[model samples]
Every structure is written in structure tokens, then in C-alpha cells.
Target: MVAILAADVAGYSRLMGSDEEGTLSHLKALRRTHVDPAITAHRGRIVKTTGDGMLVEFASAVDATRCAVKAQREMAERNADVPQGSRIEFRMGIHVGDIIIDDNDIFGDGVNIAARLEGIAEPGGVCISDDAYRQIRGKVDITFDDMGSQSLKNIAEPMRAWRSRIDTNSSTVESVRPTTETAPPLGLPDKPSIAVLPFQNMSGDPEQDYFADGMVEDIITALSQVKWFFVIARNSSFIYKGRPVNVKQVARDLGVRYVLEGSVRKAGGRVRITGQLIQAETGRHIWADRFDGELADVFNLQDQVTSSVVGAIEPSLREAEIARARCKPTERLDAYEWYLRALPHFYTLNRESLDKAIVLLGQAIAIDPHFALAKALAARCYAWRNPQGWATVPEEEKAIAVRLGREALQDGDHDPSVLWMVGFVMWQLRVDPEGALELYDRSLSLNANCAQALALRGWALATAGRLDEAVPALLQALRLSPFDPEAFFTMSALGCAYLMARRFDEAFKWTSRALRQRPTFAPALRFHAVCLVKLG
Candidate 1:
């Protein structure tokens, strides 16, 4: 009796079609260097090889199973850095039974069963028959998922199958171990990147876990549609579920700069979701908040949580990017990097920092003329300078800002960030309220989770004396971004909307809320002082 292992490259034809030469080269090198050596070390003999697969025979079921698991695990590590669409993965199956050997090539029911099992295994995974599982059960330090009976193709009887789980700590040290003290970090993308960790279920019922998982999945899907963001896939993020994880390590592993983690709790027919966004590299908490709603409206509650979480995360990531920029000298950074460093200076609303922001933004634009976000932000500085009484020639600066804003919109109309910023420049620099409102509406349509755009639309409506129209958008923005970096902006907008509606008490309440978030925020302070004076 011999343990027969059969393996096939999943999607081999598709891979070949994408890059035929590269695929053939990689596959051949992998077999020569890793697969053959592993088999030899485990006392297995290659029976035959096909263009896209191979068959091997081992003296014992345990050795065959070990070799398969180790090979699959190593293959995963090898493909970790490969682009998702092009990465090569394998599905392996093992079976143990009597085989008829002819001309040193094995043949029989054993090889047929193994091939059928391979058809049912997952990519980057291993599956074994009942006979092989029974032989290897106590011999190896690995666990198998009972896949139940699988009706394999061209097989007479249903075969009981067990799939091997990727053991994170498998003893395949030589191939699977970290290469150095600092394992290679995933490279960051051109734009901001983030990974949403699986939310913990705190409801004390495993059944409620699905609700939390569903929420995260929806958030991931929503975030992916934001265009500028590079969101990690759900399968990669969920691997950390049920494990105590280090946020920084996860960020490095996933190659994301930001991480979002939270928990779901349900009690007495109400659901509560608490989430926190973290700057993984710096170990800083950027924002945190909680939402509560009745279970009867679970779907709406999920939407609320998703919008709020998305809204909060954008500003949090922006702030973290600003902080990072401040750490390095502006001269040392490139166009996009310098632009990121300039944001904190602009947000401080001070004369000196605002000037500094414009200068940095200028350098960014010079480096990359087509950089739409940099252009939009630079235009904003010009627009903002007039309001701060810092621009010596206000009309000239306004014209320049409008020109840049239009240029940004030319290529970046589809980008939510560009639309929002350009809209702000339009309103503040050119005083084109109609144009700003149109842009904001377009932005919201593109990204429903755009809290800042919603807040800006509210502010615009309130300032134009459309209180009823403004109030709902402002309140929704606040609900979505409770810990927003621009909390004062949202709160003050809500207050102004209420003030325009002749609700003086509610106006005072929201203005005070803004003050609580940022004691000296100019807009909030003005709103609070105005509300108090109205009451007097």
C-alpha cells in the first residue's frame, strides 16, 4: 500500500493566458527548487508529472500529508506579495490504498480517488480521503476540518473528505518561518490604505456574530467604492478573527496604514455598535464612537453604523497623514507626501500655518501638475486666505483659486474628495452658492458616506436661509461622525441650521456641543456667542 498525493494548479489556463512565459517560468522554478526538495526530504517519489500538475507516492500516509500541508503553506508565503489577480495557488489531495505499479508509474483506484479529492479541495488547501485521514490522524500535529462525504467526479462511491487548515504555527520552519526579525511589510499603495478588522461579537450568542461580520463586510464594500482608498479584502481581514491581534502587526501584514476595530452588543431588543479607528503605525487612536438602535431596525442601524464609521475614518486618516507629514521636514518629501504634511497647518486656521500650507501645496503642485487633490487643497488655501484677512489682493487670489478649482474638477469630478474641496472653494472664493450646492449633491451621490460633504451642504443651505433643508443633512453628518476631527464644524453647522429655523434653545445646545469638542474653534465660538446674545 502507498499514499498517493495528487495536486493541480487552480485556474492554470487563466494564469497562462494572463502571462504565459512568466507563469511557465515560475511554475517550473517552484517545482524544481521547493516541491521536489520537499518531497525528497519526506521520502516521497514523484510518479509522474503533467504540464500543470503532478502525482507522487509516499511510503506512509503521514509523510504524504505533512508534505502536502507544508507545500501548500509555503506556496501561500511565496505568493503573498504577488498581485491578487495573478497569484498562483494549488489544491492538493491525498489517498492511501493498494496501487498497481507498472513501468515504475503507479495506477489504480488510489490515484483516481486522490485526483477526485483534489477537485473538491480549496485553493491553497489540502484534502484527504477517510483511509488517509485515519492513518495520519494521530501521527501529525495538525487538525482537519471534516468536509463530510463529497461526491467526487468520475468516482463510483462517495468519499469521506477532510480538509487541512493552514496552521499558522506549522513546523514547516525552513519554508514558512519569518525570514528576519522584521518580516517584509506589505508595500503601501499610491493612495490611503486601510483594513477593517472583524468586529468582535459581545452579545454572548454566537448567532449574533453574523450580524457583526455582516456589518464589517458591508463597510468594506462601501469603502471600496470611495475610489481614492485601497481597502483590504474581507478574506484577508477575517483571518485575524477570534485571535488576540496587535494592531501595528496587522497594519504591517495587511500593508494598510489605518485599522478599524469594533464590537457589536445586543440586549433587550437593542443593538449597540462601538468602533475605533487607529493610526496603526503610531499606535494612536484617531477616533472612537458608539451607536445604539432598536433591533427591529437592524438594517437601518447597520447603514447608520457604516456611514458613521466611514465618515469618521476619512477625517481620522487625513489627520494621521497630517501628523506624519509634520514629523518629516517638507524638503525631504515628494509631491503627495508634502501635500499630506501640509494639511495640519491648513486646518489650524492660523495666519502663519495657513501661509505655510499654501507654500507647501505650491511645491506639491509644481512637482506633479496633474495632482488633483493637491490642486484642490491649494485652491482652498487661497479661498481661506481671504476669509482670514491674510490675502493682500483678495479678488486676485479668488480668481486664482477658482482657476485651480476648475482645473481640479476637470479630471477629478469623479473623486469625492476633490468634489467636496472644489465645492468649498467655489462657495468661499467665488461666492457661487448655486455651484457649490450642485457639486455637493454630485459628491453625495458618488459617496453616500461622505459626511463632510453632507455637512457642507447643510452649512450652505443654512447660510442661504433654507433652515428646514439644512437641518437634516447637518444632523446626519453629526450622527455619522461623532468623533470627527472636524467635530466643531459639524456641530456648528447644526447649530447654525437651528438658529436659522428660529429654534434659539436648540441652537445654543448644538453650539455648546461644538465648544465642548474644540474650546476655541472660531466658528463654534461665534455660534455660541451669537446664541447666548439672542437669548439675552
Candidate 2:
């Protein structure tokens, strides 16, 4: 008999997408520094290595459990200093059974069971089959929870499994952060941060759990595309699944400012998903909504929930940030601090505050040359300046803004905000309309929830005389971000698209709505005047 251990990185594809070179280097370092040594110490033999996974064989199940626990604990320690998005975490599973030893490699149901268990194990956790659990029952000084019978993929028959829980009191490093210590609260990120707790299945059918999980995963993926906020990865956030957790406690553990929790109910070919966003620090509910649809429209329901949640959170976060900025003195501000201070000013949409916003952004860029967000926002300021007749050298300012926009795109290719901002600059500067449309498409590809990109895409298309296509895109953008801070952009784009199609009344209505949001927005003002003239 052999104790087989199989392990793999969770969300390896996402990690690579965010930073490919860093992910490979970190994996190599982890294997060399922690994983290989732990296996050798437990007298475990590495049978084979797959790109993001490994299979090993050990003589004793207890030794295998010990090695897994030790390696997981060390991984948590190693990731303490790393950013949450870039951390390398693993899922491990073990099984002890008869195996065919072929040229130092093991095969058969034993190895298959191990791999299947690893697939279902939580990130940074370990799962073991009943046979392996029996061997390590009294020998290993660890606690295991019966996970019940799991129907694993490609495996015949269901297998009962147990998940190992890291001992809070005995762990060498803290696996779970404390929730209620009095002295110091967890530090918040520079921008809005959120954790989406896995949705509960209210239908009482265990099979419905997968559907609920899939919806939450899609929501998480959508939320991560928002470049202005920090979102916890699915692997880390799923740790709270099926557990009774307090929002405040989750915030502290995850170091996030906000928490989103929800439930899913499916019955009689209808589905309902309800979600609420809470300000974790204050324990106050910021936004809540519910969506109901037919089972066939499940994806559309998910899109609605995701869009509504994102739309509500954006204004709430902006208001909170403005309030926070007002409380802090601007004299001691760093790059991030300066960026925060500039936001309230930028939102004023006036001459004096907009000028101050530009100056603060310049200071922020001076402190951190590679601050892509700051650079992008500064480029936006210049774009705003030239059109408002505030630029002393309009042509020169446009050229400089385009250069900064390009630099920001190069530095933040994977970031949605940078992509959108560069596209916005390209369109406003009249640099290249086709290139601007491509950037908008790329931005939306990264984050479908980016209403700003969709709106710009509509505008670009409308200007290129594609009014039929532009109207629907603009309308969709409006639906996605109804109360967006820059709702004027979407509304005006819709008006322009309508005007091109010679829909006078519809153009007038949208232009009026745009004027309500920002009377001074020149494009909207111009569109509104023309619509009225056309009506008269």
C-alpha cells in the first residue's frame, strides 16, 4: 500500500493572467524552498510533477498528513508579505490504497482518488479519503472534519472524505486572522476593497450548491474587472463558504472595507438571487437588491445582480472616500493619499477644484513615476482642461496627455481603468477614433461591468456613422450604471446616437437627462440645444 498525495495551485490561470512572469518565479521558489524539503522530510517520494500540480507517494498516511499540514502552514507564512491577489496557495488531497508501481511512478484508483479529492479541497486546505483518514486517525495530531461523500469527476462511485483544519492555537503561524482584537483594526487598501462571500443555496438540494457557487464565481470575476477597487480572489473568499461569519469579522480577516453576501433560491424553473453590500467598518448596509428570472435566463440574472451591485457600490464608495478625504489633512499626503484627496475635487466639475485636482495629481505622479492610475487620471485632467478652455497651451496639453495615456496603458495593460482612461483621452484628443474604439473594446473585454468603456464605445461608433449599433450599446451602458457619477456621458452618447438616426424626440429626452446630471458638460449642452432646435 502507498499513501498518495496530490496537490495543485488554485486559480493558477488567473494568477498568470495578472502577472505571468511573477507567478512562474514564485512557483519555482516555493517548490525549491518549501515544498521539496517538506516532502523529503516526511520520507515522501515525488512520483511526478505536472505544470501546476504534483503527485507524490509516501509509505505512511500519518507522515503524509504531517507533511501537508506543515507545508500549508509555511505557505501561509510565506504569503504574509505578498499582496492578496498575487499570493500562491494550494489544495492538497491524500489517499492510501493498493497501487501499481510502474518505473517509480504509481497508478490506479489510489492516485485517481487523491487527484479528485485535491480538486474539491478548499484552497490552502487538505482533504483525505476514508482509507487515508483511517490510517492517520489516531497517529496524526490533527483535527479532521468529515466532508461526507463527494461525487468526484471521472471517478466511479462516491468517496467519503475528511478535510484537515489548521489548529488555531497550535499553528506555527496564524492561518486565520483574528476578528476582535481591541487595539488596532486592519488597515484598509488605498481604494475601495470588497470580499464577496459565497452565496447560500436555499433550495435544500445539495446539487443546487454548484449553481449557487457558479453564480458567485461569475460575480467575483466581474467585480475584479473594476480597476478602481480591490477584490479578494475566489480561493480566499470561498474559505467563508457554508460557515456562519460576521461581516465585520470577514472584513478584518480579509482586510477589506466592504463585504457582499447573498443567497440563491431555485425552484419550479425560476431563480432568485439577492445580494447586499455592507460597509464593514461601520457595519452599515450600503446597498441591497434582488433579481428574479426564469432558469433559462440564469446568466442574464447574474449579469443584472452583478451590474446592480457594482453600480450601487460605486457611488457609495465615492461618497465614503470623499468623506474620508475631508477628514485628513492634505499637507502630509503621499501618492495614494494625494490621489484620494484629488477625487472630491475632481468630482466638483468646476474650474477652481478641477485645476486643484490637476495640481494634486501632478504631485502624486512626481512622488511615484510608475503610478499608472495617477498617470491616467492626470491625463484625464489634461483632456478635461483643453476642452473647458482652461488650458494655456491646448495643443501642447493634448500632446502631453496622449503621451501620458500611452505610458499608463503600457504600465497597466491588464487594468481596466487604465485602458478606459487611455481610450477616453484618445477620443477627446481626436488622436485616432479607430484606435480609441479598439482600446474601449479591450477595456470591456477585461471588465464587462465597465459602463464607462461601453459608453465611450457607443460615442466612438456614433461618430463613425454607425448609429444603429451605437444606440443599443449606449442604452446598455445606461442600464448598467443608472446612477453612475458620470451618467452624463452615457446619456449624451445615447442622445448623439439618436440624433444621427433622426429620432428627434428620443434624442431630446436623453439630452435633457444628460443636462440634468451635468449642465456644464459641453457635449451634452450642445446636444440638448440642438435637440430643442430640432423639436421647435
| Winning candidate number (TM-score) | 1
lDDT of 1 by residue, 464-507 (tens): 89888898888766544433557677788888888877788999
Question: In terms of lDDT, which candidate is strongest?
Answer: 2
Per-residue lDDT of candidate 2, residues 397-432 (tens digit): 999899899888766766666788888898988887
Clashes of each: 0, 0
TM-score of each: 0.44, 0.43
On a 0 to 100 scale, what is the lDDT of residue 280 in model 1?
76
Q: Point out where model 2 deviates above 4 Å.
A: 1-333
Looking at model 1, the pairs that clash are: none
